[model samples]
Target: MNREERIRSLLDRIRSASLDAHGFVTELELQDFRKNLLVQRGVGMSLLMASECVVQLEAFSPDFVAEHPEIPWAMIRGMRNRMAHGYFDIDLNYVFQTAKHEVPDLVRIVETLLHIHPQGE
Candidate 1:
């Protein structure tokens, strides 16, 4: 895959991960996420997947990343670093909030970008 193909692929992966994260929280509350280890792991992994996609996307030129300001590119990459490195200090509250709220918005933003840009644009 070339640059555009790679970017599109990353965007698709991000969208999928974001949706997965959102789905993990669909019928639950913060307390539920906190108590359920499996749900927490599911959400965390979804977030990790999304963030990892952003990490790869960010590896491309800054200008390409800058073109899409709607997405929280820096935050996504930062979350990846934190989740990957901060093994003991991971904040479940923040993770829960992000998955419950931000992931859906991220999905919408990514979908919009995909629609606006189109393939190989």
Candidate 2:
């Protein structure tokens, strides 16, 4: 796929991963997620997936921030770096907060950019 398509795919993955993580706040959902290591792994994997998406976008899109200066590319890249190199030091609380607070905003920004970009197809 082309760059814009790749970016859209990444955003879609992020959205899907965020949906997968929706249960962490609910006691019933948390219980279900906690019961199986696979479930927890899935949640963690989603974060990694989102992180990878951001990194790939940064690498391929030269004008990422130039095109959408409102989006925090540096912060996103920093988080991706942390996720990649500091995986052992990752804090669950931070990840939880990011998933809850940041992912939605990122998804929105990405969708908006895709809408504006002529090459989004």
Worst 10 residues of 1 by lDDT: 55-64
Span of 10 residues, lowest total lDDT, candidate 2: 22-31
Please give the CA lDDT of all the candidate structures.
0.88, 0.63
* lDDT tens per residue, model 2, 79-112: 7677778767766566666665666677676567
Local accuracy of candidate 1 as per-residue lDDT tens digits, 83-110: 9998778999999999988888889888
Superposition error at 67 for model 1 (Å)? 0.9
TM-score of each: 0.93, 0.67
Best by TM-score: 1
